[model samples]
Target chain A: MSTATETPAQHGLAAHSHGAGTKSVKGALDRFASFDVADHSVPHGREEEWRFVPMSRLRGLHDDAALDGSDYTVAVDVDPRVTATSVGADDSRKGSSTYVPVDRPSARAWAAAEKTFTVDIPRDEIIERPSVIRLTGTSADRGAAGHLVITAGRHSKSVVVIEYDGSSSFVENVEVVAEDGAELTVVAVQDWADDAVHLAHHHVHVGRDATVKHAVITFGGDLVRNGTTLNYAGPGGDATLLGLYYADAGQFIENRLVVDHNTPNAKSDVEYKGALQGKSAHAVWVGDVLIRKEATGINTYELNRNLVLTDGARADSVPNLEIETGEIEGAGHASATGRFDDEQLFYLRARGIPEDLARKLVVRGFFASLINRIGVPEIKDRLMTTVERELAVAEELAAEAAGDA
Target chain B: MSTLEIRDLHVSVETENGPVQILHGVNLTVNSGQTHAIMGPNGSGKSTLAYALAGHPKYTVTSGSLTLDGEDLLEMTPDERARAGMFLAMQYPVEVPGVSVSNFLRSAKTAIDGEAPKLRTWVKDVKTAMDNLRIDPEFSERDLNTGFSGGEKKRHEILQLELLNPTFAVLDETDSGLDIDALRIVSDGVNRFSSGGDKGVLLITHYTRILRYIKPDFVHVFVGGKVAEEGGPELAEKLEEHGYADYVGEGAAV
Candidate 1:
């Protein structure tokens, strides 16, 4: 249960996506070189990069449609030490220092965002509490666009949380930069109202000897497709990307990550776990890691595990590792998707636990390891309560199915 | 006094060929304050009897009657059976990862007893029990049986027997993978469970070494899915010396 912030030195650095036993498409990152909307066209289902996504569900996010209406809003809560400023096109944090859009949706969203919300940690400043940014979208039947840029000054440390709620079609780009020797923890909590659709491009760059912890937690949404890319600016940098998601009926949650090991002696560990229940609940996790020939002594391992809790729920996990020079440290990836373990159920039931309770215990235990690793106590408590609520709904569905039989 | 009565129990399991019979007309009775050891050779359906009694779904009791204190045990689920004072120490214990031993034991205790254990005394009880079984205190923090050695798993079984304290327990080869020290420790735990003169034990094994520590009042030689010979402690010594070669052939009285 040791968290990324606690042992930041190990399980650190680089970004990636991997397929367990199949060849992974490496062109996704290559296509990410341009921020101009004209450079990246709308994706059709035929392309390898856009096949799994339901293009119609994007709600015109990919067609360069004008972001209409003003139903969604952002609320910032932070200490005075950290400043949240509204910057323009000439802002210092803009330009190539940030990530280029890999798809039409991101490019259009970036172009449409009139104001870029920027949060900066003062040089060598340490903030004790995490800053919270709440994005609440009204069910106004309109699409909205936004952009956020977060940067940590030299030798500074802080946690920034971006939470999404309510219902609307939303597309945004978030860029994070950790300066040399700085530590940053960015938590993206997408607990949206059920009808919400969010497409986000999250890019993070870690500096020399710096550590960055990124957490992606998604529970509610019609569709949430997150592509989070990581790259190290200097050697000895560390990046730990953690993700947890739960998808229910008619919900789709996808996490695509690319951790680039371009700097020597940098390390990274990627762990993403998800659960799916109810009819048509789908979860997809794609982990790809690319290590350059000069990136020697890189210790990186990516893993994705999914638990399918009921009938008609699907979990797809792919972990791919591409290493140019195998001479440095160990590099590997693994992914697994399975239903509840029968042997574990039997063991619990044989010891006097009822079937429903046993199933809940098994699932809770399956995710408990990662849940316990979260650094924030309030978030941890809230997640557990949410998990219990989901289990209760699962129990009702199971009872109904049994009754129909 | 409580009593577990099994009569003419016939059991079968589903396979590729469909429903292969495993138990054929086996009869046994265990009363309070009694220790009965059922010894058998390999493929003699010994484990099947234990699993059948525990109400495993795979092993269907095709024809039989089982009762506990005049109550129909066959109608109850496995958890209900456990709550009704029946315990089975499995031959191969299943591992539960990410679930700490402390939480697991307390969960079972709470479920069976229908109440949460008192935190202070329950912790003490678990610590003392683990100490008596020679288990490290850190074991309580580890996942249940995951990566545990054979001896540790066996001792953990006995540990449950001691803590759960069921009126009747069927120990299936609890001595198979133990060193001398672990064997004595586990047997001692079992002896402590039945020492009150109010519990019953149905110890199943192929070897006689465990009998030295937990003496059985009755010994039954099982073959071809049923008991072929029944006697006292001396029968165990006889079988240990003569072996079960004579019990496997046809025309051997059931």
Candidate 2:
């Protein structure tokens, strides 16, 4: 309880303090970015980033797994104004974004993917409909890797949605870049099958005066770990990151994010909420925001909230903020894990709402605002229905377990 | 007519030290078209009796029984009690984010009536009710009780009272935080509910300000977790002028 009053620096890793003009240094949890897999060591479930993740269930994604299998297919739907092309691995547009893989799986995926799917939005054009990318896995035994680069041309506005489903052992790297004065929104929906194991790293770079919105909604998959990073390429960039995941029985879901404010006068906000139910259902959220010495006048806040619906389920939330200078506008972080509130249920029941229906309402209310921010009506409606289904299934399982007892 | 009877009810709540009894033997019977006000000083267990009637899990009924029309209320869960025509306007309404007031009202109505309401008539009823209560048209679109002010929360509670149309209502300190205007509005709402001549009410309060608006047929002076005296409307005016000093000792009301 005493830790509630402690600052983020005391709760998480703290770095060295130096005067102005001092050379920059990396702190703990700040892994170096590289294209070579050798630059990153294989995780053994003991590292700071991989500690909360179940390493055994990752299916060698964090180790030396072969990533050349062609058991998955990719489909893209884009308007004639936009260009959707699959270029060679060594194309010039591959590494246009200010991002590099900071983990072994990401670096391995970057090296092993033979084709780079690129989506380019023309300059100053506002796309009427979102470009859709759908990936389906055919085999759970075979491993696959993929790389996707989406570039929003200068002052252009567009939204790209990526959907993943079916069973497979997969790793991928997604690069997003918003050029100067552009507005871009990228939504990734991970509705994989029960046997699927996936590891995804999404890196975003915001240019001068640009705005970027990234949303992640995960509903299925036996083991899923998503790592997202945000960096400002120039000054006055704005970024918003939103995530919502529901982990059912025997499901493991992890979302780790890093927001690096390297340029001045930039603004960023991160919000991720999750719900877990049933035995051995685990959910994890790790948010880190770093404000460098030169990054003045920046405003940033990160929030992570989790709701545990039943007994034997677990949720881990860690929010870390490192400030190198106090000249910024403001920076803060918040993390909280609350159980299904009995008081809420009691209030509803007193109003003639049954216990089951009341529980569904509360959970739906918990995720409503965040899901609405996805800005895609079809996706939002589908996700809402999926959440309702999940709650019903969870209740049925709880009833069965009680009957057995 | 329906009758709610509480016979020698003894209730206790769990604390760190163990069970602490809050309500001694309390006997009261409320019939349809009758309004009863329970007035007491702080720590007189006024809220406990209200919670005990609403079937809150925190308050344990150690002795006696509660029934509506000879049906045992003790055996019914909170929702069952509600479906049996019981409603409680909580002192502090819980905030449920993302659930619109319209949706919640519809769901509760469905649950109570065992079927969904007619869309056109229900919508018109809700609008008329909200308009009569002086609530904004946009109020029903907002999340239930989220970011609502004290007065707004009180009005919303009364709104539920009218929409649910229960046979009996137990209002616990509904007037504690309301201002004069909001109090009048809420009192009016309660008046409208009981005017149907087939509903019962157990209004609990610590002040007589709300009594001036909604007249009670019976007023019971509660002290030390038991009823000290029972009377009609004039008793409320008397207490308003003299205060609870006669019921409890000097400075004991604190």
Ten-residue stretch with the least lDDT total in model 1 chain A: A1-10
Give per-residue CA lDDT, model 1, range B1-254, as digits (tens): 78999999999987888999888988999997999999999888899999888888888999989989989989999889999999999989988766889989999999999999999999999999999999999999888898999989999999999999999999999999788898899999999999956999999999999999999999998898888899999999998898888787841444
For model 2, how does the per-residue alpha-carbon lDDT over A124-215 read when each residue is reduced to its tens digit? 99997999999999898877999899999999999999999998898999999999999999999999999999999999999999999999
**Residue B121 local lDDT, model 1:** 98
Q: What is the C-alpha lDDT profile of model 1 across A294-372, one tens digit per residue? A: 7887788888888887799988887766655545666766788888887788778888888877777788887776666
Residue A130 accuracy (lDDT) in model 2: 91
DockQ, each predicted model: 0.47, 0.63
Best by DockQ, which number? 2
Q: What are the TM values for chain B, all candidates?
A: 0.97, 0.96
Chain B TM-score of candidate number 2: 0.96
Alpha-carbon shift of residue A248 in model 2 (angstroms): 3.5
